[model samples]
Target: MRLELEKRPERSKIMAVVSPIAAVVATLLTGAVIFAAIGIPPLKGLWVFFLEPFSSLWSIEELVVKATPLILIGIGLSIAYRANVWNIGAEGQLTAGALAGSLVPIFANSWQSPLTLVAMLALGVLGGMLWGLIPALLKIKSGANEILVSLMLVYVAQLLLDWLVRGPWRDPHGYNFPKSVSFDGWQTMPTIGDGRLNWGILFALVAAVALAVLLRRTMKGFEIRVLGEAPRAGRFAGFSSDRMVVFAFLVSGGLAGLAGVIELTSTVGQLQPNISPGYGFTAIIVAFLGRLDPIGVIVAALMLAVSYLGGEAAQVALGLSDKAARVFQGVLLFWVLACDTLILYRLRFVPGLPAGETAR
Candidate 1:
């Protein structure tokens, strides 16, 4: 009898370039299979989900709207991940930022303009930073696991938003709905071409440009790379791990907060229980899919946005359930993880099994 064990493949220099594309293609193929299983034609489903969004103005607008927050959150995550700081609580930070930014609008009910927007954004950044600082502090002082702390905060923030909207911040006028009072003209987000599309798109584009420069052209960026690629080297060079952790989390949290600010002012125009469709969680996928590059995130975000639109199309055209779209998103994420694994490790066969090997 012979025993077999798979060996990891050698690292390929070309895998870096091919991994993301492979992930995308694999996701598409998997989605097609799902469509076939659901009694729908794969070609028609692909056309509706991928092509139809770009064929019309309204659908394209929706794509931009969906992609905006995703890009913003992805940029922050790219920076954090590159610095070796794992922050999984971006969703919580987002919720806190939205709630903090909306306080002025809810209470004042009189002041509104460019200034209000600026204050709201500033508060959002502060709130998110503070939220991120919690785990950072714990990790620094007590050697706590940042991943657990950050992820747990997401549920806390979600509960807080629900409490505020349903109890204290509920709209006092009209009917008893779990929503905040809507902001007037100046308080609302500015649109593109008289449509629901907001200046958040501009903000997203600006952030992408800035992060691209920050990651590629700055001294601080080099430090982050050093910390991530070789932590021991960073320590040998006298870099402070504690400081880096705090800095990375704060910056990431602040960006997520900025995303929340844009989302509230531009889309919902008021506080709601569900501010996002889990953009914060999904941005993690975007960061990895983009290979932790800011410019690549822009493209990845757009692809994800296309999937969102396609899911809607499937719902309407093929009478599929909302869960069907979720399945596609999950498939995309799975394929991305699998492709990244292949990029990092290849499989090989050995002539014979070594000692300690057992086979059926």
Candidate 2:
């Protein structure tokens, strides 16, 4: 027998809506099996992976802290994905932003003003946009594959960050650690309480609302949607592909950059060799899981944040490795893509034909 996948003339909107939910359920079920394989009770492991993060106010606060960057980067990725502009280098752009934003803070640490924080954020955005522009411009002018270009740049950015933190930017008196000097009190982000939660959460929320408005209520938003769906139609309607590409890259890169700076200044408070724990890549899943909507991205980001917390909780509670949590995320992504694929195509089963061409 053979199996085939045939595309549908029209996709089911209901299936589109239900696919993500179904994927989540599938992930939970698969996770249960994985836990049971490791000699742990499936229910208890699931609880630790999904529910334990919400058991306390402190954990909830940590969830917000983790979700902050995810939401910020996810929103930016949604913009790019909506316009069909493949920007797989949000990680690179984020690193670029962190490097640029920390320029003044690290090199000119003596300077302190009310505007120091603002300036760093602005620099970060500029850096991210510039980094984003490279692949966009390459794709526009040279017909290069943006997916490849963007992904390659991620390694370059990571190497650059490693070099800086381990070399010139390394703290002078920090026992030879590969990290920049910590931000001073004035440079730190304001916190809501005595915890690590900072004002960045408010920024992410406002950005989400703003992006929702832009996507739903503006002409640019319409252009992005149309261009993504049908480029010929977009061109016929007087939209410029080049313009959309640039705009998408700029907006996406800018947001990612801002997110990098906020994460650094608010959470880490110093430039380091590894400033991000895959926030850029994780945001891609967030963007897709959230259905490319800003509000949805926020919800998706929270879910992922919970996954991280749950992963740690599982490690402490059941002696599972950190890789177990990453496995859960991978499974979730696999199921999501699988569901999306089935949404657009149906399986066709057939019995096997004769082994030889006897008739011919």
Tens digit of per-residue lDDT, candidate 1, span 1-360: 343434356656687778888988888888788789878899888888888989988888999999998898898899999999999899998888888888879887789678888888888888888888999999999999999999999999999999999999999993999998987766767787987788888988998999889889997888888999899999898888899999988988988988898899887889989998888998888888888888999999998888778878878988877666667777787877777765667645556666466454
Q: Tens-digit lDDT track for model 2 on 181-237?
A: 999755767899998799999989999999999999999999999999999999999
**Candidate 1's TM-score:** 0.93
Candidate 2: the clashing residue pairs are none
Cα RMSD, each candidate: 2.6, 2.7
Each candidate structure's count of clashing pairs: 2, 0
Error of 2 at 198 (Å): 0.9
